[model samples]
Target: MAELPLSGLLVLDFSQFLAGPSCALRLADLGADVVKVERPQGGDLCRQLYVADLALDGDSALFHTINRNKRSVAADLKDPADLEAVKRLVARADVMIHNFRPGVMERLGLGFDAVAALNPRLVYGAVSGYGDEGPWRDKPGQDLLVQSLSGFVWLSGNADQGPTPAGVSVTDILTGAHLAQGILAALVRRGVTGRGGRVDVSLMESALDMQFEQLTTFLNTDRAQPRRSAVAHANVHIAAPYGVYQTADGYLALAMTPVDRLAELLDCAALEPFRDRSTWFIERDAIKAVIADHLMTRPTADWLAVLEAAGVWAAEVMTWPRLVEHDAFKALDVTQLIESAGGGTLLTTRCPIRIDGRILTSPRGAPRLGADTAAMLEEPMLDGNARVGE
Candidate 1:
């Protein structure tokens, strides 16, 4: 029943794809009034970015997932009238987010300096493939490309396997999270100084930050490339038993546990020689091979029962169907239902943050293209020098 943290702030989302829009989504989740400023022609290109060929209402499910609980106002930045309207909106916005290439927004006359001139308290956030003025600045800031360039693929999969990217858009999601963090920090600073600042994040930088543990180890060590375990590979830098192994029936994941304890627990004589802690990383592949072969003797449930009983960090690797059906997942109450444009409910995740022991839930779905354009333009203050939301 507590009021949301960002209740009165106005956020203008100018980006089309994942990173910038996702940051806006989080702000919207926290009760910020977020408005998507999109091109009138097609709205967000993500509206057509269908995943699993799924569409919700008129837009792709992917677009709906990131854009729910937000309003939309369409504009053509090149058109004088639309540009003026957007500038007015920017003048009233507390935060403005975009993922255009370094100089694109500058060319559009809506760059940070220009917007800052209109609203000194506006937090300007930008997302890119790489930092501005870098060779990669012009490269498309897509998730997969950033992951491939940031050495993230090398950290996953086995040494013998081909480079494998994560199934999800990990870089884009993390970059969005990083941008949100930077925006929040800037907002806090603005509360103190009465001035807003620019926050910049790149998918490549976020991808590197995600590997801080392994990257730091690589930097401090001999600087050799990390080698993934040939068997049950999970973490590139971790020792044996830190991976998912195939049981007789299904998969079981094991975290860091003492080899001698695991040997005694599983009654595997092969692991008796690996009791020395220092040799774990050096002999990880060999140890993982033995563990892999031994674990295949029992089903995942049997291993989980023994491991859980012994207080070992182990679990059955579950599929999405199994995970969603489990009581533990159900208890989290992670999903919410939003009413779509046509009066049907669309199931999506609720905001994960808990405030005052209450979860934030909203039934608002993504808006139609330019759904709020007239209303926004018709706001009485938009016609004058006065800030609209102020």
Candidate 2:
């Protein structure tokens, strides 16, 4: 087997919660040595941030899912001895990440300037709710709040319904991805210049970036608000036949198919007159209503057979159970089971990226709180002026 891309890299993760830890997790997935720095008392608050009330090995399943393949070290920034140890680790690390509010790091004497002075080749990554100097900088960087603030909530559901945030913490995940991208770019630059740079990402900025297509349209089109169809519209900008409709047995989703072709295929006389492409957006609701009523007359499998035969873009809308059990899903082989140090096991999705046709898989689970503190502190270089991992 080939060695992983980031085998020798060292990452110091001082961030808690989703955004920062997720970035470090990706680094670890690529075989970076990631050490999660957490407060000594309870470690990362996310250890208890249960999703669906699920816990694994005394930590939240969500925490276990994200923090796999990483070690943990406990240190209180307020303690001079512990802070000194962390600074030494930072100096040896190739990458450092944190999601503290604007002045928190500076107050702890580990801001970018201080850390960069100690190690000029350290890539400092930071995540915030908003930009560091904005009016909303002091606000909590929670995913749901960022979604609401960035107008992401208005993008989903029908016209009459209230604002609906996404089912997941999309902003946090996107911000993590952006931070990772920036970190990688900085690493590439550092390879040439031997000087690391700061990479900053904000939840609001990431949330806005996620809607680039629709947001660009809205910005250039007279500032008009997105007009969602009264019926089952998938995207605010897309025309008819771009949503899920209820079939007799299940739901069927349709992508952008020509109205005349669909009318001929489904034998719907009402759809024949809307052959002109210009009316698709304007009469989207009306066209969707007709399509919905017609689709309900047949089972999802029957419509899928016809649509598949007609070369139309359509599929059955499957729930999680059906999706996981499908042959196509199983063929991907994207899930893995990880065992924690305490002997607890969890079945979770693996990293989506593949290198050289090999899926990245590791058996390591999240560390018990401060599990590596003694070993890390006892390293030979930590006691002298030399860097911790040097």
Q: Per-residue CA lDDT of candidate 1, range 140-250, in tens?
A: 988989888899889888888888999999988888999999999999999999999999999999999999999999999999988888999998877888999999999
C-alpha displacement of 304 in model 1, angstroms? Answer: 1.7
Question: What's the TM for model 2?
Answer: 0.96
**Local distance difference test scores for all models:** 0.88, 0.89
Off by over 4 Å in 1: 381-390
Best by lDDT: 2
Give candidate 2 misplaced runs (Cα > 4 Å): 381-390
TM-scores, in order shown?
Answer: 0.96, 0.96
Give me the overall lDDT of model 2.
0.89
The RMSD of every model to the true structure, in order and in angstroms, is 3.2, 3.3
Q: Under the 3 Å rule for N, CA and C atoms, how many clashes does model 2 have?
A: 0
Clashing pairs in 1: none
